[model samples]
Target: MEVRLTREQVLALAPDAASSKAGAGLATDGKWGLLGADAEALWGECQGSGSKPYQTQVDLAGLVSRCSCPSRKFPCKHGLALLLLYAAGNPRCVPGTRPAWVDEWMQGRRDRAARKEAAAEAAANAPPPDPQVQAAAAAKREASRWSKMEAGAGELQRWIADQFRQGLANLGNGFEQDAQRMSARMVDAQAPGLAALLDHAVSGGGRDLPSLARLGERLGLLQLLTQAVPRVESFSAARQADLRAALGWPVDRETVLREGEALQDAWFVQGQQLIEHPGNLTERRVWLHGVASGRAALLQDYSHGGRGWDQQWRTGYSHSGTVHFHAGTVPLRAVASEVQGGTASAVPADDTFDVAAQACADNPWLPQVPMRLSAVTVAHDGQRCWLQHGEGTLALQLAPMPGWSLMAFAGGHPLCLMGEWDGQVLHPLSAWNAQGEQWERSSA
Candidate 1:
């Protein structure tokens, strides 16, 4: 039997808000007719103003949508409506053979996918370019970038010195604009990390001495980068990548794939969060814990202009997969290469608070370390809540509702809790009691 998707999953595939709304409006039986679904395909016809009904088909395996409607959207409203009806188990969508149109569309998609895979395989097996030529070209590119970055850094240092000479008190009137202008120069210097830092600094209210001190710290960091860029290769691969990332440089996907540590394990999804950034971009962060390896990895996905993500990682699920680690960081962050189907299950809390502290000890810049606290109880005093795990008690950074929810879920008993421990605070993600049932606590 084919797996059914939830209405939320179906709507998440829509390209934009307007498409989702339109698809929702067309989900009723009156708007759709002749609905049929097989193991491989789901097809339906929707009545529109035109004489002939619009044909819609969904490739179940790929979850690709096709519609004969005049809309330019990838999955037109008709396709979304068809999937909605099918997902809802509407009787109108009875089991049947796929029509010729649906079969033909599916065939085309399969062919294209096959071709893409073949091309990728061929490219991977191809021989490398001449070593001498490659070396010379790389050297030239590096020299050019070095010159640009050096000039940008020099200009930034001068600007910082000027700010210091003029004093922080006198720079309030146009400080924001000044920072933005300097940031733009950094961007022109191809130092995106520095630009982002400046933007971040200015975005925070630059109205006080503390803010000015923060700006000074940023300048100090940039000064370090100016010294580091020339001899980047001297650092470890992972550290080099981190530095480049900090400098707003991109890592080549192919390079990482070819030269990275591979770990195969049953990874449990701890939790996932979606954040919206400026310029209408969405950032998705998925945290995973390797059951056997006891390793934590983070997978990041980004979508632009209201488009949805390519893949979905549900919280509280576990799956077998191979994750490739980027060189040079501890408490590793990785990119998933292959993931088999996942099953909904309770995530085991095996590691302890000391594990988090050790990770932070290794990498002080690490913002969050995964920790599992066993024999832990929520301690609330009507004003604040804290988690008493093992020998240590730590305060939780949660609002009233989530804190109360945790208390209710624990119910005065010691439960195993899983969450990230930033050096100072514990951000609970999920928890499970002795019976292995998940303790439903909303993320704060």
Candidate 2:
């Protein structure tokens, strides 16, 4: 498959081509030679400010892998920006053999494909098990899990009681180690629900004295499960499911990965934080904002047991852009601001909440505001903001001062959608809606 981009389109996409080329930053005439007639489908390369160039080849037929950048954002910005440059007739070098960097990438792809094929082959060749045999084995395992859960819950309850008796001076004051140890045990006991609970012991996620009584009541239930198996049995099937779910007892990974109902828009990368526990499950939060809708969204991609996100995702403040992304089963939280806008005027007053909004603040450390995640549709909404296009939105209320317009997405769910009655098309803002016990973010 061949990809083509008109010269003018490239220029619009790559505002830096003229300046970069005029500065003689690249090989003369080679840019166009590489672009050729079907430049859009060609491979892309990246040369850092002072580093050697790294090349990436994309399979035009499949829009699949073949890049040197260590980013996992499918068809990352580098890929899109490269195409944009070609469309502008400013490609700086003629396409040629894969560079050493590109070669490494090719080999990596081959290795991954080989592993996948091997795994599939192994599964296919596995001996079939009798259904009854499997069922009986499963029952025995279930019985063992219940026994383990009872012991774990009983121990956890006693631990909480001891802490309370010692006087909850500082649930978080210096319990990081304790919290971590307990959470790890909880995970082992199939109570991943308890790990975050342990984290909350100090994070203020516990809701403070204001909600302490309510929290105690919740804990009391877990404590009861310690000594009495019958009490655990008393819990309704629904309640049992809830308890197990909170325990993080292995839900269908496929379901968590489903991510239904999406919209394509420019998701702002607002703030980011990485979390790791003793067991080493790593979670990354790459928040986003839509420029047109001025809505906020979150891009949460996690890895576990010593693994991490493919890359440290970037946040951006921008003119406007779009991309393809999926919504999670639950909405993630985020802080949305412009990629390069001036410092934020102020964060929200609520200091206790993890999800809060702020004005755009282009932290001076980054090169420029990150680019759009994917191609986006532009709507002339009267409001001055950008957001994910589907269930979420970004309605930026640009203030008079040179500051940022920001919104918060709690648990990544849009509590309310802010839409603008554009002179023509109505556009979306931030979305904050509830879905079951989880929240969702919009890629749509």
TM-score for each model? 0.68, 0.49
Q: What is the C-alpha lDDT of each candidate?
A: 0.74, 0.42
Q: Candidate 2: what lDDT? A: 0.42
The candidate 2 region of ten consecutive residues with least summed lDDT is 358-367
Which number leads on TM-score? 1
Off by over 4 Å in 2: 4-42, 49-61, 65-73, 86-95, 125-127, 170-176, 205-237, 254-404, 407-444
Question: In model 1, where is the ten-residue run with the lowest total lDDT?
Answer: 435-444
The alpha-carbon deviation from the true structure for residue 373 of candidate 2, after best TM-score superposition, in angstroms, is 25
Q: Relative to the unseen true structure, what is the C-alpha lDDT of residue 195 in candidate 2, on a scale of 0 to 100?
A: 61
Residue 115 in model 1: lDDT: 100
Q: Write candidate 2's Cα lDDT for 208-322 as tens digits.
A: 6755654554445445434444374776654454445445565443433453233444443444434454554555555455545544455445654332233233322232333
In candidate 1, the residue pairs with backbone N, CA or C atoms under 3 Å apart (3 or more residues apart, or in different chains) clash, namely 238-327, 238-328
